[model samples]
Target: MAKRATVADVAALAKVSSATVSNVIGNRSGKVSTRTRQRVLEAISALNYTYNENAATLRSNKSNIIGLVIHDLSNPYYTELIAKINRQLAKKGYATILACSDENLESQQSYLHLMQRHNALAVLLCPTWDTSGEHLAAWHDLSPTITFLRPVGSHESDFIGIDNYQAAYDLTRQLIADGHRQLAFIGGSQSSRLRRQRLQGWKDAHEDAGISWNDAHILYCSSSMSAGSAAVMQLFQQTSDVTALVCYQDIVAFGAMNALHYMGKTVGGEIAVTGFDGLSDAEGWLPSLTTAEVQIAVLAEHIVDRLLARLEKPQEPPSVTLLHAHIHWRASSHGDVDSSHAR
Candidate 1:
């Protein structure tokens, strides 16, 4: 094996002190002659020397890296959001360390510990389904942490998420106006704060309209296309009177659409389906899904911005930002009036 060159070797060849070589490499010299710097560069090139990044980070107490914790990478929503976050963070001269929890609380906590070991300056978390204040507090004590898509309990940390409750409420209300009285909700664990908000909105809308809230219509499923499809099937098997379905996510809506197609039923004509998280595929679906368009890119940008700001100023008060979701109407629903007019 060949010996690796060090700064001392370059200094010995350049006839300069190691400090001079360090100054030249870091471009921090003010009094060193340009000729001296040039000679150090030439010696470095001859030695094929590389700076020790780990050693440098150890001295600086920073890794110049941020941690990103998401529930699942298989979902297109999180993947797209990560892409946006990566692009924006890279522009700020930072890198991301990604971790997937698979909606498992234990797995998420383990990843947080790993991130802390890596000296992550901050963490942007898409919390697990069972994110409690205790879990968030433990992570926050390790490093500056911010909640992205899903909020963790009510801990005072930066939170950036769409108004899931209002979005779901509006979608359900749209269905109600479309003559969909017997509605069903598909996907999402009721324990999750985000899911709870959406469910509350559904209940509020029905209650405001003087309609009875039916517990049997609410179906809990994982946020997946398969889950959505299964929920639709289960709903039909239990009660065939469901005229509209409100999915917690667009992927679930996609699954329900597939289930409807497999059952030889028309999506828009036979039953209306609305989804949250306006995924790109929603626009191209056969019936063009009606959904709440969550500004994912904007949300990612804001979350990164907040996280970086917190990293720069840790003592600052925590921020809570709620972005609104726009309801996009298409052929999936029966209403012809624009949402703006309904509002």
Candidate 2:
């Protein structure tokens, strides 16, 4: 048999130090340049060298693995975010292990335990509504964890998410400017802090415009297409005066539009519809959706940055990073606003 290739052989062939070769193989932070990394990779491929990951884990007490625990993988919002996150992590030679909670607390806790067993270096979590501070603290003991999208109580570890209240407030304010007086907020459970922040934004917009927001118009439901459709149906059945529907997400907005079409109401003409989370398919709808554009790629980058930072400095103070989101006005929300307010 041919002699097995070693790290020394790779370093000699790549014309770099053994330490540089090790850094490239382990994805450790160093001053290795792109040119050197490429040469090391080429040498690795040419030599068909394989590092024993299990032995490495034992020696270093860490794995080249990151756990991603999220709610509702079925939602496009999360799927898009994961795509960006996967790309960014791969560049650093790390692999991701994904777990879906379906918004169930037991399932989420179980998945966290599984990640701990696998010895993941850290976790990026989008926690469920019922996930308590105590549960999160326990998970933090297993690994460095960062919460995203959905936030837990104050005592939870570091969090990275958009400014939900400001984004929602801006969208609502624009709809009001378009002469929508009788509005309805749809799709979100009352128990969620995210939902509450968004709801507060809508309420604030109404108050600023000197319009009374009716409690009857605030409909609390699951953030889904079916729920949005059902809620819109109920709203119309009660009264046809709701001229605009502000949905918690683009999927819910799609459902609302479908219901409106079935009811023979013309979206963007007879009644306006707006949504949050600027999804990829938003622009493809009959009358493109008006939504708050959360930069998924940017958000993913920030999330990875924070998670890695936590891993390096585990003793650092826990902090929150809130990114901004902007509203994109399209045909769905009537498209009649001044050109300056389009985005």
Candidate 3:
């Protein structure tokens, strides 16, 4: 059996110092003559030499890799965001190691440890409901991290998310303007900040209109399609006067729409539904949904950019970026309402 080629052998064949061979193989931060680099590379190829990344990382103390932690990869929003993140990071010559938390804090913490073990330069996280700043702070002591989608309630890191409050506010106001006096909200876990924001927006819109808010109309759901379907049943059971419903997300709206169909109700003609996160399937629903379009791709790119910027300048103050939302009016809501005024 032939022995594996060593750096020394490549150096001897290229007629360069071992350090030059190391520089060529590792692409270290130093100027190596192009001719010498070519010779070393050629020698390495001819000798069938394989570079040890671990050994290279030990020498440079840099992994050139980023960790991406998401709560639910199965969600269409996260899936689309991850794809955009991958494309943006690839353009910067950085690779991402992705982990799904399934909205479990313990699983998310374990993935963070795994990233630490791999010497990740930085992490981009979409934390679970149970995640706290202290938990993130403990990890921040090990390396830099940026939170996305959901904040962990820590000032120790950066954050990027859509303006949930404003988006929900505008959507609800649109429904109100369309002659919907009795409005209902569905699909949100009581513990979610995003849910809280959207719910607050609903309240705010009602307050601005000088209409009394109804606590009974707000449904706390488990943030699933099934939960949304059940919530729709619950809403109708409790309040028969609700002419419109605002969902926390498109998937939830889809479920509620399905329930309405099951109950023999005409969606656009009798009742209206609005959803957030302008999901791909929104346009295909029985009555095309009116939704607040979050720029998922733009958010992904911004998060990556912010993470990289922090990597380059760790001492910089943490940044919190909130992106605006656009409303996509469709067949679900009445078309006569002036949607142009929606923020």
Candidate 4:
């Protein structure tokens, strides 16, 4: 019989320490240079060595696993942010586990419970719309969590997100300036804090401009292209005067544009459209999209930094960090504003 391979054998073959080999094999996302990691992987393959993850967890008393919980996994902006965070955590010697809530409270509860069973080192959560202080307290018992986008409870807690209010306000104000009086605030979660903040901004902008907005124009839908398309159709059925659409995000904006095109309406000429989350796809839209850019890289750095800090000082008072948004004007907002305000 052939002798069984071991971590020591792989480490020696790779010209690295046994611990490094264990880190590579156990977590697959540990603090190692890309070259060194590849070398270790090759060595493991050559040796046919495998380590028991349960035994490793028992030995280390830490899982080296980070849980990422979010509402929608399909959004490009969120996906980009997750990729950056996954890379950053890998460099810090941690593996990531993702759980999508699909904005459902029950699903969020199930995923959080699963993370608890794994004894996750920490969690980065984009909270469900219905999350409350009581719910947060229950979750705190499971893992240290740093929330983003939607925050719950009055209790001090770690949170990092963009200024939803200001972003919406700025974009709506610009659309109003472009002679769009009847604007529809489209695509929002049922009752999310971020949604409320954004809706308030849109309303406040109308008031500031001395324009009255109809309550029926405020339409709520999931943050999805199909949902956005349906919402636009429904809104137009309700009223035809809505010349501008203040979409919740870029994906929704794309759907709105597609719907308008199907209706034989010339976008940017007769009707204007604007959205948040300056996703790359927005720029490639036929007429292009005007949006508020929330820097994902910056948000990831802040999120990871705060996560590490939380792990270090579990008892420290919680804090909130709101990142800035840069507005990019394009033909989607107005045909003339493209040259004047495009970024």
What clash pairs does model 1 have?
none
Question: Model 3, range 1-343, lDDT digits (tens) per residue?
Answer: 9998989999999999998998886687556988889999899999999987777778888887899999997678789889999899999888889999998899999999999998899999999989999889878988899998897787789999989999999998777777777788898888999999999999999899767768888988875688889999988987777778899999899989889989987787678889999888888887899999877788888898898899889999998999999999888876442233232
Candidate 4 worst ten-residue window by lDDT: 334-343
Model 2: pairs clashing at backbone N, Cα or C within 3 Å: none
Give per-residue lDDT, candidate 4, residue 260. 90
Ranking by lDDT: 2, 3, 1, 4
Clashes of each: 0, 0, 0, 0
Better of 1 and 4 by TM-score: 1
Best by lDDT: 2
Candidate 2: C-alpha RMSD to true structure equals: 4.8
lDDT of 4 at 100: 93
CA lDDT, every model vs. true structure = 0.86, 0.88, 0.86, 0.85
> Cα deviation of 76 in candidate 4 (Å)?
2.9
Predicted candidate 2 versus true structure: per-residue lDDT over 66-154, tens digit per residue:
99999898889999999999899999878999999998999999999999888899999999989878888877877888999888876
Most accurate candidate by TM-score: 3
TM-score of each model, in listed order: 0.87, 0.86, 0.91, 0.82
Tell me the TM-score of model 4: 0.82
> Which residue runs does candidate 4 get wrong by more than 4 Å?
1-53, 154-156, 336-343
Better of 1 and 3 by TM-score: 3
Residue 321's lDDT within candidate 1 is: 86
Model 3, TM vs. native: 0.91
RMSD of model 3, in Å?
A: 3.3
